[model samples]
Target: MENSTVPETKKDVLKMVHKFKTTFQRLLSRENQNVIETDYEKCETNTDIEKKVFGTQKDWMNLFEDPSEDAKCNQFAKHIEDGLKEAREKHLKCEILIPCGLTMRIARDILIMSESEPCGVRGCSLIIHLQEKSNCTELVKLQYDPTTVSTFEIHLTLQEDTRHVVSVRKMMMQLTGCFKHSTYKSTPKMLCLAYKLEKQKLYRANC
Candidate 1:
């Protein structure tokens, strides 16, 4: 009777151990199954910190996202407008590179004059450089002045079909009228006003 009881006890202990082991394994498997997998990537050339962190293949994006291509394009335009504002603050003189996305024959605006004439004078001139992405570093100059503002717009509209448009507008400068005649640097004021108007316009347009 003693030997029989000993065997029964050993069997019971072994069964309990096996059951505990199975339960532990099941728990581990379930936890592993619920764990989410994620991946991320970036451009080969981009060195910006934001680019590094969220450049590609993100498991999560911002809380907000645009659902449509037109929305994305409009966002891009807004970004460009913001960048121009910063450029104006720095008094940065740079060319305006028109992207290929613009439709042909869209009227563009500019002030131009000849180099020989003073900027405020009637015959003053300004130069514009047009180039495509391939030749971005090599700017093709387009000369203009206050008198030819409309003509330049027409030329730009017509050239859209033939060539990529690049804007050579600087951060801020005057070309004609009483504003040009004033000796005071008016780039900041102009930039601020433009930014305010654009912000309102774009916000309403998007709305």
Candidate 2:
């Protein structure tokens, strides 16, 4: 009787271990499914927000190509406004690269400039002055002068080893400076401008 009871006890212990293992696996499978569902929901939410902010892909493409239409221009301006707001809220630094040529023309139109001037320059004198003030090995900083309207102050410093790229700081919501493209022969130069969007007024006001 004792020998028979020992075998029965061993069988009971084995059944208990198998039940626990199966239960743990089921819980793990449910947790994984929940994670996947949550990720899918987040992805759907982001897609909806993107669609709301920037219409369809074709609409955005057309807007970038030709911002001559007031409605399209307003949409682009709103996009920029959203970006600025998001950056501020997230405490992020934002930078915009305005390439030379057709894109630059579109930017000028969006900024409501009368003439198709590169870097939004009203005259050649300012471009010449900026080119003269710039150096190859130094980082140049340009900021709007408070004393004079549209006047900029230039600051230069030795290029550090870590500073491989040149960037304009403190020129928020305005054209900072124009620089020659380091690479790419087709595109000769590019403009650094951070725009502050003012909806319908963006077409009327100069930045």
Candidate 3:
């Protein structure tokens, strides 16, 4: 009987190699396509999550762009209180409301940095530096029409630190211009003018 096994040809070997290579390439391309699709889906999911959290892209960016003043003030308030050394260690806590025209509009968002200064006569002084938003100047211009100046700073001084109540009261009066019995353009004169007008109308009707 003759040898049953036949010798493999170079052409046959080359064809087998090519087939294997083609199969491997197809698998590699499919894997790459799957990876790209997965990444795209993940990015879309992140976008949706962000939209749910912040409502919109502009609103999300604003959280980082605008200054958080209320949070800063709340952080500062904690350090403002302390204990004093006496026979018994007494704790002194001060609650303060800063009244200023600068804070009227941007009170929540305006950045305030405060430092304590020791005064010779008064107990202490709190100097707060303010920074408004980037477009604050433009916003103020659009909102207000000033007579002499577009923007101004006011300095409020008190008789002493203990007289904060009196100082705040006086400042409130000056800023808002509201008093219990304050007359606008003279109330008596306005009433007299009204009476004269009424009398003249009556006389014309009689004639």
Q: Which candidate number maximizes TM-score?
A: 1
Q: What is the Å distance of residue 44 in model 3 from its true position?
A: 59
Q: What is the lDDT of candidate 3?
A: 0.24
In candidate 1, position 40 carries an lDDT of 13
TM-score for candidate 1, please give it: 0.20
Q: What is the C-alpha RMSD of each candidate to the true structure, in Å?
A: 28.2, 25.2, 33.2
lDDT of 2: 0.29
Order by TM-score, highest first? 1, 2, 3
Model 1: per-residue Cα lDDT over 112-190, one tens digit each = 1111122311221222122222332212222223343322111111111121111123322334343454434543121
Report the lDDT of model 1 for residue 202.
Answer: 9
Task: Give each model a TM-score.
Answer: 0.20, 0.19, 0.14
TM-score, structure 2 vs. true: 0.19
Off by over 4 Å in 1: 1-67, 93-207
- Of 1 and 2, the candidate ahead on lDDT is 2
Worst lDDT window (10 residues) for model 3? 190-199
Local accuracy of candidate 2 as per-residue lDDT tens digits, 96-189: 2321222222222333331232322221111001111243322122221223333211121111111113323222213433323322222122
Point out the worst 10-residue segment of candidate 1 by lDDT.
192-201
Model 2 segments more than 4 A misplaced: 1-49, 64-110, 113-207
Q: Looking at candidate 1, what is the lDDT of residue 73?
A: 38
